[model samples]
Target: MRHACFLTVGPARFRIGSDWRAPIDQLRALYSDYPMDEVVPDFTVRLQATSALRRFVRPQVAIAGDFTLPDAVPLPLHHGLLAAEMAMNLQMALGWRRHLLLHASAVSRQGRAVVMTGVSGAGKSTLSALLAERGWRFLGDEFVLLDPETGNIAPFPRPISLKNAAVAAMEHEIDDDSRFGPVLRDTPKGTIRHLRPRTEWIEQMARETRPGLLLFPRFGFPRAVRRMDEAESFVRLTQASTNYVALGERGFDALTGFVRSVPACAIDYATGDEGAELVERLWSETGAGAGDRAAAA
Candidate 1:
């Protein structure tokens, strides 16, 4: 490891060490708002070169960490920052026990949260980022932290990874150049850029919101909203959750309870404005009850 950085997101902390300084420098800049811990990190990510000569030649970043997939391939040196972020997420997905991790995006308004999950192109991240721009607190963009015991959604608002058209969508909303990272082309997810979560949101990470609603949002479709039955919602969530099976009975109880507790909706929208309108209407109609429950959760 040539350079290293340590930071914490929500309850999970990470220490990322890289053979090259550029990636570590980029990670440090992107997560500069976060505080480093003196205590041991929950997970460690090492971005090392495949061979000694590769360090000076076309460098490769091997994603070695505390928890990792065996078949994972090394990335080019230019993608070190992305590798670091992915490494951190990998650790939480494979190892964390404090919370039931959902591959979902979340946003909160006045302490009531909306957890949205779907397939890769679902646009949940875009929706959550758009909602945050319109005054909703951005809870998370990658994984939403759900405490199985308490059913409270803790804030895990890491930098939002925007892809393809999503980048232009955000550019239309936010004018802050500082929040937007460099637009890197020809990546695994097409053109990619990261949007740093607002400082106020990070400062208020201590506040936990109860899940008021569950959304399975799809973009590039006509405006439509459908309610999901408990059975349907449960099955969908089971597929979306990375550690539901590992958490065993506790995960089952929490997820089942969440399904029964919150209303579930599947919304289709062609644009961000339409998505925001639908979310506002739904929140107004049912957000109060959710807020009340969050206090107790």
Candidate 2:
């Protein structure tokens, strides 16, 4: 806990303390666009050595914070940056109660947001990152914050964690080298790197957008789109949400209202390009309908 840094992403502020300075330095450089001023943090994460001897020997970083998994394995010192990121995610997943936390990625355009969620490797993260590079404003690449009372989407705008093929794909899409973090190979989810979102999106993190569309995207498949019903979308989202049951009735009301309000679809695409195209087409159709429905209501 000798080295520490404060980070504010959207509605959450985090204080990450590390046993070594390397992780803190990495965080500072990557999150340079974010608000790092000293403030009361919503959550705290600690990166400590696995053992007293490990601090001097082959140092290993263990995730310790307000909420932690007892069976979590420690990462080597070289992967301390990833460990810090993971620790922050753990804290948000278990501790955050201000909003309904959906394990999804989101993007906004014309003041309306699209929420995408699916299993890991489902291409939601990649799709959101790709759209961010395009005309869409990146809201978040991890958790989509849904205000329980208003049912609006709060932007998280954390760095997008690109894994395996995604890392290279984004590198090809974005020419700027300064926006990417160091590559950490052979991690839990394979080779991983962080892509810093556009500075404008980071600066606009506090702005919230109305939900326009809900997508469940699956990658590496032939292109297809299926309309999803409210009941099914509700059940799926309950599974996708990290703190749904923890929030109890408030979570249920928020989620039900969300599914009922937005148009839901399950999209499958073989490549990132196709995925982006699918989203664009659907938004044109569904987004217009959302506008009409809002007017009618």
Candidate 3:
């Protein structure tokens, strides 16, 4: 690979090498503020031609990196930023064991973190970004890193990936005009855009916050909030965590401690405003400064 870009996000460092220069340039521009002081990355991502003939024929980009799935497929070069982001996520999901990784979005305020995870189209990213815009400091939009030892969330704070309707949601909800990335079209998730988290989030990336609440968010539903029992929360978290099985006893202990330490809730909402108001009400009911675990499912 002739062109390369290196960046550090939270505790993970990445080196992205590209056969074509354009993708690397784009990554460099977006992650311009991330530190590059470390010479070696925790993981390396390679974006190269799919095949010998495919290289010159159609010019497709294949995401092959330090770690990859056997069924991994190549993507068009135009979506290289997405590929790079996916590659980094793959590394964290498959290789990271230093922390309990949850496919969640998170935000922090006053030493407490709100972690949200759910199935696709759950609007977790949009919700976390919205919370950041309001008052909470965005921890991350991709993977929420929970330290197995301390149970505190270490910020990943990467760009928020908004898909389809989410693009318009942020455009109308947030006032800042400069925090957005280019609108990419005709991709896996339809029209996609990247929104940079506020600068405060990045500056406080090293800061860790204790879990305040665990939320399973569902969008396009009537507004409701239900308590999730520890038993069910544990099962859901196992599915949410990519390296839970790999961590064995350590993973079990970390997860058990987490569920027992924090309260879990399943919330359904039709719009962002409703979701925000409901969460505020829930927080207030939890007794303000304390993190109160829901007593029953």
Candidate 4:
């Protein structure tokens, strides 16, 4: 049997048969126009589509050993495909030994990249949109992959996911022409919007950037900017990182190395203007202003 489904996150390919009783062939019979690829032996998954219940007479069929979620809803939907795509992207990002994946937003200016690491409510997306509007190149809004070997950051360049007040904050920062696409209303995270990527940087979306500074930004009162010591910064960063649980010992080593090698700080502010100024000051102090390369070791 043949079946075809495409995902947006990574490589757009799929094959629906081989390990399971020729399901792909059955699919091909129904939809001759759909494309098909021979399923690889290693790619195993169980079949649990609602439609399968009528054909197999079993509640679920184990496809290639991976258990598919039981189908109470519908069959042949894109949920599995979507999950696979996300997994693939996650795998690809983690595959690089040179990179330690952090949950953050990254932006580049004058060839230097600054990564902002924080939790969901930590103003990362807001700061990222603010920086992009001010002519800084947007690397990514959620994931910052820092190369351990070269100390450079690579761009994942996914859509900038913003929530609630951030939407208004971004609207105020950018003109209508520069606004990213449209605002998505009433998302799970509360009225979300995805800022479209800058087209000029699309080709270089996967390019690596040298780590100039690591920032932990927060939105709060009594705003203050302070440079943190390496140890303190490392502690805070470890807490803020996303994939640290998966990285384990290797993650620890990479995080420690990064803190020691680069300048890290915490910026507390209530507005984008202060955040932008703090970032600008960091770049200037590091000697990475326009037309200037960061000072060499």
Candidate 5:
């Protein structure tokens, strides 16, 4: 805990303490656009050595904080930044309650948000990142915050965690090298890198958009789109949410209302371009600019 940094992403604030300065430095650089006023943090993350001796010799950064997983493994000191990012995600997944949290990626256009959820390799992250660069505003790539009462999308524009092929794909799409964090090789998810969201998006993180379209995207598949019924969408979203069960009645009401209000689809694409194009087509068909739910219905 020798070095520390504070960050505010959307409505949540985080205080990250590290045994080494490298990870803290990386976070500060990557999140330079975000507010760092030392306000009270919603969650605290610690990147400490696994043991006393481990601090100096073969240092491994253990992710410990307000909430932690029992079987979480420590990362080598070089991958401390990834460890910090993972820890922050862990905190939100386990601790956050003000909003229903979905394990999804989101982007907004014309004041309406598109929430995309899928399995890890489903390319939701890449598709969202691609859309953000093209024209849409990046909401988040990890957790998509859903306001239970208002049924709005809260923007959590943290840096996009690009893994393996995604790192190269995003690198090809984005020209700014400085917007990227250090390339951490051979992590649990393979060679990983972080891409900071555009400054405009970060500055506008406080804004919330109405959910317009819900998507379940699957990568490496033949191009196709299937309309998803409310029942299937509701069931899938419950499984997608991290704090749904914890919120009980509030969660149930919020989720049911969301599925009823927003139109959902399952899209399969073989490439990022196809996925992006498909989303655009779907968005246009949904009449997101008009904020009309009936169009999808």
Candidate 6:
């Protein structure tokens, strides 16, 4: 059996298996991995993935391979890189609660979670990167978890993926060479990197926050920011969500609850700087405040 360890983005426990190890030695060596101060034990999630294709079916958790790659053909590391994410989505879809699977980039600040759902070219990654750089807690660039019961969002803490022009922007912004991993060549999207979030935040990987805002970010001319109605937001979000149709009535209830509770907006910006400022203003507007909210149910 192959052995590897990962820190997932939900509430569960410290899981163990013949194929994995915990208290990640490399992560510990690089930086002190400590739990968040306001630790919520109940929200913690720990699980293992034994199947490759099945692992890529979810949102939050990811997997790492121990086997050596041949020099001739580059392995599909990114697909494998997101195994945990796939697992998270699968777990949520099958779990008891009804959640609308949204295709969005999500993050947290103060105490609230914000999801930015958009199509492939809609600057979701760029916006997410901007938020992460501007002190917002990174939830995910590709997936966001929403709790059906309280209309709150859960953390899907994983690496921030940057592609094409976004990569250049990040390279220009950060000084540290170690902050990024080796650039992979020829992905369907483009060349990419697994961006490392602040070590302090990574230590708090087990932490989950509530859903406070939903935004459909668009990049184009006449740059401006506008608030979207909850009803319209719900429609768009439902479409972007991964397993909305699969979850049925329970999923609809969860989505409606989320739309009602969280403020939804449409962010229009051409540049990352403007996008970052818009998010900052939104964060301040929301009552994220100082302390963390209770973890999702």
The digit string of per-residue lDDT tens for model 2 on 152-191 reads 9999999999999999999999999999999999998899
RMSD in Å for candidate 4, one decimal?
8.1
Candidate 2, which segments miss by more than 4 Å at Cα? 288-297
- Report the number of the highest-lDDT candidate: 2
- Candidate 4 at 22: error in angstroms? 28
lDDT of 6 by residue, 1-297 (tens): 344333334443222122233223323332224332333322223333435553445422233222211231222333433333333344444342334557788878666777888998788877887777777888777667666666666665556677778888898888786777557667545676667777766766666677777778887645777888878988887788777877788778988888887777888887888877777777667655334333221
Regions of model 1 farther than 4 Å from truth: 287-297
lDDT of 4 by residue, 196-240 (tens): 565555556656677777888887645777888998978777776
Clashes of 4: 10
lDDT of 5 by residue, 21-49 (tens): 99999899989999998988999999999
- Candidate 6: regions farther than 4 A off: 1-7, 11-99, 285-297
Compared to the true structure, candidate 3 yields what TM-score?
Answer: 0.94
Question: Which RMSD does model 6 reach against the true structure?
Answer: 8.4
* TM-score of every candidate: 0.95, 0.97, 0.94, 0.67, 0.97, 0.69
Error of 2 at 124 (Å): 0.5
Whole-model lDDT per candidate: 0.87, 0.94, 0.84, 0.60, 0.93, 0.61
lDDT of 6 at 297: 18
Which tens-of-lDDT digit does each residue in 1-297 have in candidate 1?
Answer: 668888888777888888889998898789888877656989988988889999989998888889989988888888887888778888988998888889999998767798989998889999999999988999999898889889999889999999999999898899998998777787777888999999999878778988888989999999999989999999999999899999999999888988998888999999989998898888767754455456568
**What's the true lDDT of residue 155 in model 3?**
94
Name the lDDT value of residue 255 in candidate 6.
81
lDDT for each residue of candidate 3 in 1-297, tens digit (9 for 90 to 100)? 788878888888899898888788877777766776657889999988888776667678888888998887787878888888888889889999889899999887667888899977898888898888888889998899889888888999998999999899999987777777777899888988888887777877888888888899998899989999999999999999999998888889889999998888999999988887777666656543453343331
lDDT of 1: 0.87
